[model samples]
Target: MTTDHLLYLCFWCFRSIFSVITFSFTSSVFAQQFDQQYLIWKQQQNAHDLRLESTLTHQSAEAVISKKLEPKQALATTGLSTASERVNINQANVQQLQKLKGVGEKKALAIIEYRQQYGSFKHIEQLKQVKGIGESIFLKNQTQLAL
Candidate 1:
């Protein structure tokens, strides 16, 4: 072969080998990057799963605790007595009136003052005329109110 031809062949072979090496290096870098991204995603997924499990565990514990309580204990925790035992708003004292839902000391006193001024609630709905007793409070205690 001529020297020029041999030199040209050598250059072409070198170029091909160089291209293959560069392609292999770029592919390895891409594979490593993909692996790193996958690991990060996996870690995030595991953390989310742990949070979900913790929430479920807390809910389950609350359910168990509620189930273990006595009926009176449960009622007291909810700030109510037996549903059958209702409050007579017309005659109830401040402490007794406070048994109604949302009726604190101030609200109970307001109810007594209203009753004294207005001569007694003619109807259960008249209890709403008290200063702090709006529709929401009246509705919450509707079932527990007596004439």
Candidate 2:
């Protein structure tokens, strides 16, 4: 090769090698910084999570205490009737059926229509056979249901 070409080639090789070494050094420094920052973030996250758990536990305990203090009032507000006041699904009207948990107007009407079409319900469990009434609805209203 010509002298000028040889000089240019050597300069390019030196610049490339210098760039690689600089990049590697910077990468290691950046990786260390990133790892340290990540550890600090994890520690802060753990502390915040602990604080949230404490707050949630305190709130739940207060809720349980309040419910225990006024169980009958809570039951009345939740539309759960006592055993003596249980709704007879075979005889209850749409409004009476609606008083059961998870039973809206549609569900109540569905129950009445089912009862009329099938005659009196032989057992409380038969309520699950109606359309829109599944296991969850039947279980929720089981205590309030009768023949």
| TM-score for candidate 1, residues paired by index | 0.47
lDDT of 1 by residue, 13-123 (tens): 999999999999999999999999999999999999999877765655565486886655555445447878788888999988988888899999999999888798889
- At residue 118, what lDDT does model 2 achieve? 87
- For residue 96, give model 1's deviation from the true position in Å: 0.6
Q: Show model 1 residue runs off by greater than 4 Å.
A: 1-80
Candidate 1, pairs of clashing residues: none
Candidates in order have lDDT scores of 0.85, 0.83
Residue 26's lDDT within candidate 2 is 100
Could you tell me how far off, in angstroms, the CA of residue 133 lies in candidate 2 after the best superposition? Answer: 0.6
lDDT of 2 by residue, 73-144 (tens): 444454445655688899998878888888899999999999889899998988999999999988877777
